[model samples]
Target: MCRLSGTKSKKEMIRVVRTPEGEVVIDDTGRKAGRGVYLCRRLSCLEKAYKEHRLERSLKTDVAAEIYEKLRHALL
Candidate 1:
Protein backbone atom coordinates (compact mmCIF):
# COMPACT_ATOMS: atom_id res chain seq x y z
CA MET A 1 0.00 0.00 0.00
CA CYS A 2 1.01 3.60 -0.53
CA ARG A 3 0.91 6.31 2.08
CA LEU A 4 0.44 10.06 1.65
CA SER A 5 1.69 12.97 3.72
CA GLY A 6 -0.72 14.83 5.94
CA THR A 7 -1.95 18.33 5.21
CA LYS A 8 -0.17 19.58 8.33
CA SER A 9 3.12 18.49 6.86
CA LYS A 10 2.57 20.49 3.69
CA LYS A 11 4.93 23.40 4.28
CA GLU A 12 4.44 24.88 0.85
CA MET A 13 0.81 25.89 1.06
CA ILE A 14 -0.08 29.53 0.54
CA ARG A 15 -3.43 31.14 1.26
CA VAL A 16 -4.84 34.23 -0.43
CA VAL A 17 -7.25 36.61 1.26
CA ARG A 18 -9.15 39.49 -0.31
CA THR A 19 -9.40 42.80 1.45
CA PRO A 20 -12.39 45.08 1.87
CA GLU A 21 -10.84 47.75 -0.31
CA GLY A 22 -9.47 45.36 -2.86
CA GLU A 23 -6.24 44.83 -0.96
CA VAL A 24 -4.53 41.66 0.23
CA VAL A 25 -3.46 40.92 3.79
CA ILE A 26 -0.67 38.42 4.05
CA ASP A 27 -0.56 35.83 6.87
CA ASP A 28 -2.78 37.16 9.64
CA THR A 29 -6.48 36.86 10.36
CA GLY A 30 -7.13 40.06 12.32
CA ARG A 31 -10.78 40.13 11.26
CA LYS A 32 -9.98 43.09 9.10
CA ALA A 33 -11.85 43.05 5.81
CA GLY A 34 -8.91 43.14 3.49
CA ARG A 35 -7.27 40.95 0.93
CA GLY A 36 -4.63 38.65 2.44
CA VAL A 37 -1.67 36.74 1.13
CA TYR A 38 -0.43 33.72 3.00
CA LEU A 39 3.00 32.45 2.13
CA CYS A 40 4.76 29.43 3.52
CA ARG A 41 5.22 29.97 7.25
CA ARG A 42 8.97 30.54 7.06
CA LEU A 43 11.39 33.27 7.99
CA SER A 44 12.81 33.33 4.51
CA CYS A 45 9.38 33.83 2.92
CA LEU A 46 8.52 36.55 5.40
CA GLU A 47 11.84 38.26 4.79
CA LYS A 48 11.41 38.01 1.07
CA ALA A 49 7.93 39.52 1.23
CA TYR A 50 9.15 42.42 3.35
CA LYS A 51 12.37 42.99 1.48
CA GLU A 52 10.65 42.80 -1.87
CA HIS A 53 7.75 44.89 -0.61
CA ARG A 54 5.46 42.40 -2.29
CA LEU A 55 2.72 42.99 0.23
CA GLU A 56 2.75 46.73 -0.24
CA ARG A 57 3.21 46.41 -3.95
CA SER A 58 0.31 44.04 -4.16
CA LEU A 59 -1.93 46.01 -1.82
CA LYS A 60 -1.04 49.18 -3.71
CA THR A 61 -0.45 51.03 -0.46
CA ASP A 62 2.09 51.57 2.28
CA VAL A 63 2.38 48.94 5.00
CA ALA A 64 2.14 50.16 8.58
CA ALA A 65 4.10 48.96 11.62
CA GLU A 66 1.14 47.14 13.15
CA ILE A 67 0.48 45.33 9.91
CA TYR A 68 4.06 44.16 9.80
CA GLU A 69 3.80 42.91 13.37
CA LYS A 70 0.64 41.01 12.57
CA LEU A 71 2.29 39.42 9.56
CA ARG A 72 5.38 38.47 11.55
CA HIS A 73 3.31 36.95 14.29
CA ALA A 74 1.28 34.95 11.82
CA LEU A 75 4.34 33.81 9.91
CA LEU A 76 6.20 32.87 13.07
Candidate 2:
Protein backbone atom coordinates (compact mmCIF):
# COMPACT_ATOMS: atom_id res chain seq x y z
CA MET A 1 0.00 0.00 0.00
CA CYS A 2 1.19 3.48 -0.75
CA ARG A 3 0.73 6.07 1.95
CA LEU A 4 1.15 9.77 1.38
CA SER A 5 2.51 12.23 3.87
CA GLY A 6 0.65 14.91 5.74
CA THR A 7 -1.20 17.62 3.76
CA LYS A 8 -0.26 15.97 0.48
CA SER A 9 -2.86 13.24 0.71
CA LYS A 10 -5.42 15.61 2.10
CA LYS A 11 -8.17 16.75 -0.23
CA GLU A 12 -7.80 20.36 -1.19
CA MET A 13 -10.91 22.16 -0.09
CA ILE A 14 -11.90 24.91 -2.48
CA ARG A 15 -14.91 27.16 -2.59
CA VAL A 16 -17.52 26.78 -5.30
CA VAL A 17 -19.73 29.80 -5.52
CA ARG A 18 -22.91 30.54 -7.40
CA THR A 19 -23.42 34.07 -8.50
CA PRO A 20 -26.65 35.99 -8.34
CA GLU A 21 -26.77 35.41 -12.05
CA GLY A 22 -26.40 31.68 -11.36
CA GLU A 23 -22.84 30.53 -12.02
CA VAL A 24 -21.52 27.58 -10.08
CA VAL A 25 -17.78 27.04 -10.22
CA ILE A 26 -14.54 26.56 -8.34
CA ASP A 27 -12.42 29.70 -7.83
CA ASP A 28 -9.00 28.07 -7.83
CA THR A 29 -7.80 30.38 -10.58
CA GLY A 30 -9.03 33.34 -8.47
CA ARG A 31 -10.43 35.11 -11.49
CA LYS A 32 -14.06 34.14 -11.35
CA ALA A 33 -16.40 37.11 -11.69
CA GLY A 34 -18.55 36.47 -8.68
CA ARG A 35 -18.51 35.94 -4.93
CA GLY A 36 -16.07 33.24 -3.73
CA VAL A 37 -14.95 31.70 -0.48
CA TYR A 38 -12.21 29.22 0.28
CA LEU A 39 -12.01 26.21 2.56
CA CYS A 40 -9.24 23.75 3.23
CA ARG A 41 -11.64 20.85 2.66
CA ARG A 42 -11.64 20.61 6.43
CA LEU A 43 -14.49 21.37 8.76
CA SER A 44 -12.34 23.81 10.67
CA CYS A 45 -11.52 25.75 7.53
CA LEU A 46 -15.19 25.94 6.66
CA GLU A 47 -16.03 27.31 10.08
CA LYS A 48 -13.23 29.79 9.98
CA ALA A 49 -14.17 30.82 6.50
CA TYR A 50 -17.64 31.65 7.71
CA LYS A 51 -16.58 33.28 10.95
CA GLU A 52 -14.03 35.47 9.26
CA HIS A 53 -16.04 36.12 6.12
CA ARG A 54 -13.01 35.19 4.08
CA LEU A 55 -15.20 34.25 1.19
CA GLU A 56 -17.03 37.52 1.19
CA ARG A 57 -13.82 39.47 1.36
CA SER A 58 -12.28 37.43 -1.41
CA LEU A 59 -15.22 37.93 -3.68
CA LYS A 60 -15.48 41.59 -2.73
CA THR A 61 -19.19 41.46 -1.98
CA ASP A 62 -21.65 40.79 0.75
CA VAL A 63 -22.74 37.15 0.96
CA ALA A 64 -26.31 36.16 1.60
CA ALA A 65 -27.48 34.00 4.49
CA GLU A 66 -28.82 31.39 2.10
CA ILE A 67 -25.45 31.23 0.42
CA TYR A 68 -23.76 30.67 3.74
CA GLU A 69 -26.16 27.89 4.57
CA LYS A 70 -25.58 26.30 1.21
CA LEU A 71 -21.84 26.48 1.71
CA ARG A 72 -22.15 24.88 5.11
CA HIS A 73 -24.23 22.08 3.71
CA ALA A 74 -21.88 21.51 0.83
CA LEU A 75 -18.79 21.63 3.02
CA LEU A 76 -20.21 19.18 5.47
Candidate 3:
Protein backbone atom coordinates (compact mmCIF):
# COMPACT_ATOMS: atom_id res chain seq x y z
CA MET A 1 0.00 0.00 0.00
CA CYS A 2 1.13 3.55 -0.69
CA ARG A 3 1.72 5.43 2.51
CA LEU A 4 0.91 8.73 0.88
CA SER A 5 -2.17 7.88 -1.18
CA GLY A 6 -3.38 5.05 1.04
CA THR A 7 -3.97 2.77 -1.93
CA LYS A 8 -3.21 -0.84 -2.57
CA SER A 9 -2.13 -0.47 -6.13
CA LYS A 10 -1.22 -2.94 -8.81
CA LYS A 11 1.08 -0.40 -10.34
CA GLU A 12 4.74 -0.61 -9.45
CA MET A 13 5.56 1.16 -6.22
CA ILE A 14 8.85 2.15 -4.62
CA ARG A 15 9.89 0.16 -1.62
CA VAL A 16 11.97 2.04 0.89
CA VAL A 17 13.22 0.17 3.88
CA ARG A 18 15.13 0.65 7.10
CA THR A 19 17.18 -2.41 7.77
CA PRO A 20 17.89 -4.04 11.12
CA GLU A 21 21.31 -2.39 11.21
CA GLY A 22 19.68 1.02 10.78
CA GLU A 23 20.46 1.36 7.10
CA VAL A 24 17.91 2.91 4.76
CA VAL A 25 17.79 1.45 1.27
CA ILE A 26 15.61 0.79 -1.76
CA ASP A 27 14.46 -2.80 -1.61
CA ASP A 28 14.37 -3.72 -5.29
CA THR A 29 13.90 -7.38 -4.45
CA GLY A 30 11.18 -6.73 -1.86
CA ARG A 31 12.73 -9.30 0.47
CA LYS A 32 14.94 -7.15 2.61
CA ALA A 33 14.87 -7.70 6.33
CA GLY A 34 13.55 -4.51 7.85
CA ARG A 35 10.69 -2.15 8.28
CA GLY A 36 9.42 -1.05 4.89
CA VAL A 37 7.12 1.56 3.42
CA TYR A 38 5.63 1.86 -0.03
CA LEU A 39 5.09 4.85 -2.24
CA CYS A 40 3.46 5.17 -5.61
CA ARG A 41 5.78 5.45 -8.59
CA ARG A 42 4.53 8.88 -9.53
CA LEU A 43 6.81 11.82 -8.84
CA SER A 44 3.99 13.59 -7.06
CA CYS A 45 3.76 10.83 -4.50
CA LEU A 46 7.49 10.94 -3.92
CA GLU A 47 7.51 14.70 -3.62
CA LYS A 48 4.64 14.75 -1.16
CA ALA A 49 6.24 12.03 0.92
CA TYR A 50 9.54 13.87 0.91
CA LYS A 51 8.21 17.30 1.72
CA GLU A 52 5.82 16.04 4.37
CA HIS A 53 8.36 13.65 5.94
CA ARG A 54 5.81 10.88 5.60
CA LEU A 55 8.36 8.21 4.84
CA GLU A 56 10.45 9.12 7.86
CA ARG A 57 7.38 9.03 10.04
CA SER A 58 6.32 5.62 8.74
CA LEU A 59 9.78 4.08 9.02
CA LYS A 60 10.49 5.68 12.37
CA THR A 61 13.89 6.96 11.26
CA ASP A 62 15.56 9.82 9.49
CA VAL A 63 15.64 9.27 5.73
CA ALA A 64 18.64 10.50 3.82
CA ALA A 65 18.64 13.09 1.07
CA GLU A 66 20.37 10.64 -1.22
CA ILE A 67 17.53 8.23 -0.77
CA TYR A 68 15.12 10.77 -2.17
CA GLU A 69 17.59 11.51 -4.92
CA LYS A 70 17.68 7.85 -5.84
CA LEU A 71 13.93 7.64 -5.76
CA ARG A 72 13.59 10.62 -8.03
CA HIS A 73 15.96 9.05 -10.47
CA ALA A 74 14.03 5.83 -10.37
CA LEU A 75 10.76 7.64 -10.95
CA LEU A 76 12.20 9.27 -14.01
Candidate 3, after superposition: displacement of residue 75 in Å? 0.3
- Model 1: CA > 4 A from native: 1-18, 21-34
Pick by TM-score: which candidate is best? 3
Cα-based TM-score, every candidate = 0.53, 0.53, 0.87
Worst 10 residues of 2 by lDDT: 1-10
1-76, model 2: which lDDT tens digit per residue?
0122355332355655656675555555556676554456556666676788776666666667676676566767
Q: What is the lDDT of candidate 1?
A: 0.57
lDDT at 13, model 2: 50
**Regarding lDDT, does 2 or 3 come out ahead?**
3
Residues 29-68 of candidate 1 have per-residue lDDT tens digits of 3345665444556667767777888767666677766766
TM-score of predicted structure 2: 0.53
Q: Name the top lDDT candidate.
A: 3
Which candidate order results from sorting by lDDT in descending order? 3, 2, 1
Model 3, position 73: C-alpha lDDT score: 98
Per-residue error at 39 for model 3, in Å? 0.8
lDDT of 3 by residue, 2-69 (tens): 55464555346878999999999999988899999888888988888888999899999999999999
